[model samples]
Target: MPYFRPIALALCAFALAVPVAAQEVNVYSYREPALIQPLMDGFTEQTGIAVNVAFLNKGMIERLRAEGRRSPADLVFTTDISRLHSVVSAGLTQPVTEAKLTDNIPAAYRDPGNHWFGLTVRARVIYASKARVKKGGVTSYEDLADPKWQGRICTRSGTHSYMLALTAAYLHHHGEANTLNWLKAVKANLARKPQGNDRAQVKAIWAGECDISLGNTYYMGQMLADPEQQDWASSVSIEFPVFEGAGTHVNVSGMAMTKFAPNRAEALALMAYLAAPAAQEVYASDNYEYPIAPGTQADPLVQSWGSFEADPVNLSTIAELRSEALLLTELADFDG
Candidate 1:
């Protein structure tokens, strides 16, 4: 069964009573409601367009395929390049050639065909224990495999999307043979069997179970906001590890227009609004992510974590390498 949780917008209550020609947009989002509610509310307040979001934990593509031309989804909101690429590859999204979109988002962050646009960027970084790991103890992704850190790393399942994305980026920098060996070496260094979410890994560090873990940048903000997790968050410092000759590996939270959008005009308005500088600021400030719009600044808290050059390879290339990355992960029995 598809897990659908509709966000309760003020407009949603009267949506059924509104005329057929009313201005509105429907979004099928893989992101949680709390993460995007402010953006939806901002768009509605600015344009007077009713925004209805259906949060789907999984199976968004299958649900859209099942609905076919009858699907009411105007936009698809998600994180990670692979999920965005999957929607485009499934033939479920249409090309958006709006100049506002093109001008605001950099080419490296958007689909070459205009099928999707990245709103924010997050680097896959090391969360190193402040007490156990010295400053500059880890400076590169290749260092994770070094024997000196044996049984000192904590990570999520090898096949999880975040891990695979990192693995995929590794494959791009080094070919299959080297990537496989790197994976095996990293796996051998795990503190325990690959387990839990990124936050859990940080918690493990606080519990003195591991010295470092791999996670996204935004997670620190999330942890700091939660009273119980603050200590877990405080125990580690964010480390931007480079990919040998390349920069830090990064991914995005992005948006796309559905191929069968019933509210094309309204959807376009929201898309443009999101890419606008002001909206980008809101997203950055509220989510602790790096805004992708040109000249847009990230939240001060995010900036304080410092920055690094994002990997120069286009995300589409990373998406293409995901399949092979997963195959290597499984073959190595990384979880075992």
Candidate 2:
């Protein structure tokens, strides 16, 4: 998607967003509790639209299915475009016709038919021990397959959405064969069976269990920002190993409107506001996420770590590659 014009906090029409009546809207979200509350609070303040939320660990599709057209949900807030597209694929979400949303979000970041839209982005990158790994040693993602690093690499399970997303990116950039081969090679190099979340990977590094691991860019930024996590987070530096300088692989945290949303107007309104510069800035500053909106800058922590090229593949493609990635994972026999 190309850049968006600077979001003007001006008179914009949200015919679809105005309240159908005076009741609050309900939302079901898959994003972490801490990440979504800020936006929810903001929307409530601006519109007096009380929001009832169901924060879930999983099973949103099932919940929506059970709730059916009777579901009180007005919006579905989640991280990752793949997850958002999955909702679209399930026929649980409908396309939004809000002019503000159409004008704010980009085509690549949002559905071509407007089923879902990206809120923020994250880069899939390597973070290495400051004491053990050299600044320039681990430069590109492809290098994870190197034999010299055997029994030294740390990662999450292959089945995880994070690694699978990376796998899909590989398939897009290289071919399917190349991506599978890369997965197998990297799988063989595991220090321990891939088994932890991103933060756990950092702990593993600190405990001397591993030298390097995959992580999202924002996690490192968050760790460094907090004093408690600073020691470990600062000890491992974020790296961009550019393959032929093509840039690093990136991902998104996105959202979509529910198909039978009771508050479709409010849902659409909140979405438009989320893509605006103000909301974009909040995401960048508070969560270390990259704002998908054009001209919106990343947080200082991310900036201080330095910048690298990000994969431009729209997230829907990432969803398409997920099944293929899972197949590669099974063939590789990765335990985690």
Candidate 3:
């Protein structure tokens, strides 16, 4: 009880001396909030900068353009190389010249012009029916077009951004003529019309509607986690096919600074934080994707799938060819 009043006053004074955190960074994200909130919480816990996110499933670029110069957005985060390139091409995003970002992310996953940075990578892989297809039946991207697999394959619409990006990567290594012919070949092999999402293709395989399908690696992780889709996830095994001499096709979930970033410094700090191993660990694990940072281990489930050599080509090159790829898909009447 001795000096109790003075001790209480001193504790109150210490509490009053602590600074309040007033800084915030606004984010416009195509990524779902539940998927990214943990990273945001971790960032705020470390730096005391609040992150405000607006989630958009579509029309992300259009929304930014409509907002124009006075836009409150400081950062844009989304999936696919195409979306990243689209924002830059529209001039809605500004270049980030941070050395910390460049040092943490690999050269292939980022914009050479520094306009965007990839946070995590997802590989385009083959899902083969374990009961029907032999282990070595499919070894390369070219095999999807082989006559032996005709009437045994399933896919989503050819024009979907995921497919378009894969088509673009195919165009990159194999050239237009081969790619076009390959597209037609794959179209001929479809067990049914391209419909639904990547997961639906796996469901088709489980129903014995198809023997093989093309999908992103994360979809397998997602399907496994879903109680309704566990059978579909168990029906197939993943095959890491390469592009002949090249490695597997990979796409990224990436970020960019908006052209009208009101909180540029905080945005950049967040971007750099995302690139570091600490944040990459949280972000990639949350999404079941491969970390862009070279040595960071993927989640145990993703790791159990084994690893393969990722194509050495920079993603910007694939983004450049997406339009041409989509045109070829239409010309081939791939879904028809």
lDDT of 1 at 84: 98
Give candidate 2's root-mean-square deviation (CA, Å).
10.4
| Candidate 3, 240-333: lDDT as tens digits | 9999999999999999999999989999999999999878978999889999786788999999987989999999999999999999999999
Clashes of each: 0, 4, 0
Clashing pairs in 1: none
Q: How accurate is candidate 1 locally (lDDT)?
A: 0.93
True-vs-predicted CA distance for residue 63, candidate 2, Å: 0.5
User: Taking the tens digit of each residue's C-alpha lDDT, what string does model 1 give over 198-226?
Assistant: 99999999999999999999999999999
202: Cα error in model 3, Å = 0.5
lDDT of each: 0.93, 0.80, 0.93
> Model 1: residues >4 Å from true position, as ranges?
1-20
Q: What's the CA RMSD of model 1 in angstroms?
A: 8.8
